[model samples]
Target chain A: MTTLAMTGRPLLQVEGLTHRYGSRIGCRDVTFDLWPGEVLGIVGESGSGKTTLLKCLSAQMEPHAGHVVYDTREDGPQDVFALSEPRRRLLMRTDWGIVHQHPVEGLRMKVSAGANVGERLMAVGARHYGEIRGAALDWLGRVEIARDRIDDMPRTFSGGMLQRLQIARNLVSRPRLVFMDEPTGSLDVSVQARLLDLLRGLVADLGLSVIVVTHDLAVARLLAHRLMVMRAGAVVEEGLTDQVLDDPQHPYTQLLVASILHP
Target chain B: MTASPSLSLAGIGKQFTLHVQGGVVLPVLAGVALDVAPGECVALHGPSGSGKSSLLRLVYGNYRAQAGSIAIRHRGQTIDVAAASAQTILKLRRYTLGYVSQFLRVIPRVPAIDVVAEPARAVGMTAAEAERRAERLLSRLRIPERLWSLPPATFSGGEQQRINLARGFVVDYPVLLLDEPTAALDADNRRTVVSLIHEAKARGTALLGIFHDAEVRDQVADRLFAMRPPSMAA
Candidate 1:
C-alpha cells in the first residue's frame, strides 16, 4: 500500500538481496521499495557494503543470492538478473546513470571535459557531434561550470567543480534514476551547500529518483526522503530520513547520528 | 619566508595560444605569484578556468611559462623549473615533482601501486624502496590492501583516488602540488583525504592545491585566498 502511493509504481524493488566478493562479504539481505521522485540515502562505514548494494540494485554488479526486481513504466517488476545481459545493459544505459565517488576515476582523464559529458549521449546513439557538443555545453552551464573549461582536462577543474562536471555528464542524458555516491564529499561546505541546492532542484525538475550512498547522516537529513543504515554489509535500520536520523533504534545507527553533528 | 621554497612561483602567467586560421594567444593566468614554505599547506580557491590547474602545471614543470619564474626545492638543492638546459619539460617533471592531477593521469595498464611507485623509480629510488613506500602510503590512506596490486583502472572511483593520494605522497618530496586532491569522494573517502593532508603536513612538505570543498580547506589550509577572476583580479 505504501509503495503504491506514488503514481509511477515502485521504480525498484529488492528482497533478500545479497552479494559477496570472493571470501569477503559485501551486502547481505537487502530489501526495499523505491518510489518515484524519492531520494534514498544509503549510509554506512568504510567497510560497509553500501556501494555493493547500490551496484547490485543498479545492475552494475550481480548479487550472489536473492533478486533485484525493477518496476519500469514500460514493464513491471522485471527481475534484473533474469534478463539477458544485453537487455540488462540496454535497460541501464538508457535509463540509469551512475556518479562514482571520484569524478576523475569515473571519467576519462585524458579527454576534454566536454567529451566526458557527451559520452553518455554518444552511448545512447546521439551520433551528431555538433548536437552532442551543444548539449554538453548546456549541461555544463546548468551545473554552473564555466563553459570555457569545457575544452580543458578534468585535472584542470577543482575537486568540487570536477564533481559538478560529473553530475553534468550524468544528468545530460536525463536518466530516470541517478545513482550518486557521496556527491558533495569533495565539495567545500559552501560549495556543498550550493551543490545540494542544485541537486535538489534538478531531481525535482527532472523527476529523477536517486539512490545516494554516503556516510554522513547529516547529509542524509539534508537530501534524503528515506534513510537506510548499514553495518558490515547489512541493513540494520531503515525508515523515513528524519525518523531514522533523529530516533535511531540501532546502536550503530545512533553512533552514525551522533557523528552527524552540524557539519 | 624560508630562503628556500619547496615550490615557488613569481609573476607567473600562462596563456593557451590557439591558432584558429591565424595565430592568437588566449591567456589563462596572469601575474600569479606565491610560494610554498616547507610544511605549509596553501589552498587555492578560484572558479574553473581561473588558472588554478595551470598554476599547478607550472609548478609541476609540465610547461614553461612565458612570463615570471618558478623554483622548487628538491632535497637540499633548488631545481630551477624554468631551466635553460633542456628542450623538454617532461624531464624536469620526472625528477622534481609528484603531481596527482584531477583525473587518472597514470599510464593505462599500470597497477595502482606501481603508478604511485613509478615516480620514485624515476627519482633513483630502488625498486624495493619504491614498492615499500607505495604500500605504506596506500595502507595509510584506507585503500583496501587487497586492491594494491590491481591496476588503478580496475579500481572503483574512491579506490583510485586513494591510490592517487598514496602515489603523490609515497616518496618524500620537498614539494607536492595537487590540482584537486579530494574532489570526487563519498563521505568516508573524503575523511581519508582530509587525514592524508594532515600526514603530508606533518612530514613538512609544502602543499599548494585548489579545493572547492570547504571542509577540506578548513581542515588543513594554513592560508586561504579568494582569487578574483583574472580581469577582476587585475
Candidate 2:
C-alpha cells in the first residue's frame, strides 16, 4: 500500500508502543499517527489489548516500550511520557480528555451536573459563578441535556443522559484531543444510536482529534475515519474504515467483518 | 458540450482479491473511461454485475482504484480522487461532491430534518438557514411535517428514500453521484426526484447516476454510458 501524503504534521504519534501485564503481553508494538479533526477507531474483541493500547496512549499507564509524542501548543512535539507529572496532569486537565465507558468512572455522581461541568472550567482558571453557570448551560444544550436539569445530580440521569453529561463535561474545556473507550457501550441500542449521532456532530463541529476504542463494528463504522484491528495483542489490520470493513485484507479482519450480524 | 467536464475518468480499473477464498482475484472494472460536463446528467446502463456501482464508489473514493485517474474539479483545481489523501477526499465530499446511495446510513436517532440539514450545515450554512432549507426540501419531497422531527429509521422505506434524496440535494454540490436513488419511491416522489435532478443540472451541477427505473432515467439522463461485465466483455 502507498503511504498517504498528509500535508501537516500529525497531532499525535505513537511509535513502537508496547505494554505488558507481568510477563504476558498487553499490547505489542502498536504504532499510528492521528491527525487533527480525525477520529481513529481501535477495534478488537475482549482481551485483544484495545484498552491497554488506549491506556498507554492517553498517559493513564506508562508503556513498557516506545514513544508517545504529542504536538504541544507551547513546546512543539514533546514526548508525553517524559513530561513531569504536574505538567502531564495539567495537560490532561487542559488539552486532553478521556471518556470512560462507565460515566461514573468519569463523573462525580454526588455533584449536580452543572458543577461537574463547571469544575473543569475552574481548573482551567475560569472564575465567576455566573460565567461558569452560563457556559455549563450552553454545553448542556449542545449535548441535548435540558438546562433545567443543570442542578440535578448525575445519579438522577439515565444511562444515556449520564453519558451525554460526561461528554459535555469533557468538551466544556474544548480539549483538542479526546480519548473515548466504548462511549456507547453501556446504553440501550436506540439510546446508543442517538448518542453516536450527537457525538458525531460534536466531533465534526469541534474538529477534535479523537482516539476511540470500540468493539462494535457498527460503532466503529459510524465514528471512525481510520481503523486499527487488533488481535492477540497486535494490530492485525489498519486502513481506512470503509476499506477495512468492506474489503478486509487481513484474514482476522475478514472474520471480524463477516461476524457482524447485519439485519 | 463546450464547457470543460466537471468530472472525468480515465483508464479506471478495480479488482477484488478475496483473501479467504485462497487469493482468488475478481476483476470488476477495467479500462473504464467517462466524463460528465457541467449541467449534464449521465446514467450508467448495464446488467447487475457490470461494475456500475463499483465505478461510482471509485469516483467517490469509497473504494480505491487499481489503475487510472478519477479527476474532479474542486475549488478551481483538479483533484485525482484515486490518489488524493483521505482528508482531501473528505473536503471534496463536503463542498464539491455529493452521493446518494440506495439506503440511508445515518445515526438512527437523529430527526429526519436534522439528518437532511446536517450536510448543509457542514458546508457553512447557519443552523437556521440549514434547517430552513431542510424543511423546504422535506416538504417538497412530501415527507409530512409531523414526520420531519422523527427519525427516518421509523419511517417507511419510501419515506426513508425521500429523506435520503433530500439530504443529497440539500447541498448544491458541484458534482453528484446517485446510486438507484429512486428505487423505492412512489410515482409522485419519483417525479419530485426527476425535478430535483433537472434543477441540479440547471444549476450547472454534473451528475453521474445509475437509474434503474426506465421512466426516471429517460426523464433525467442526457446520455447513457453502457457498461458490461468483465467476463462478458472478454
Provide the TM-score for each candidate, comma-separated. Answer: 0.51, 0.91
Model 2 chain A worst lDDT window (10 residues): A1-10
Residue by residue across B34-71, what tens digits does model 2's lDDT show? 99999999999999999999898889888888899998
Q: State the weakest 10-residue window (summed lDDT) of model 1 chain A.
A: A1-10
Q: Best-fitting candidate, measured by TM-score?
A: 2
* Candidate 1 structure quality by residue, lDDT tens digits, A57-116: 888888999987777547777998999888888778778888887887678889999999
- In order, what are the TM-scores of chain A for the candidates? 0.92, 0.98
Model 2, residue A225: distance off in Å is 2.6
Q: Which sections of candidate 1 miss by over 4 Å? A: A1-6, B1-234
lDDT against the true structure, each candidate = 0.76, 0.92
TM-score of chain A of 1: 0.92
In model 1, residue pairs whose N, Cα or C atoms come closer than 3 Å (at least 3 residues apart or on different chains), thus clashing, are: A159-B183, A187-B213, A188-B212, A188-B213, A188-B214, A189-B214
Model 2 misplaced stretches (Cα beyond 4 Å): A1-8, A109-112, A137-157, B21-24
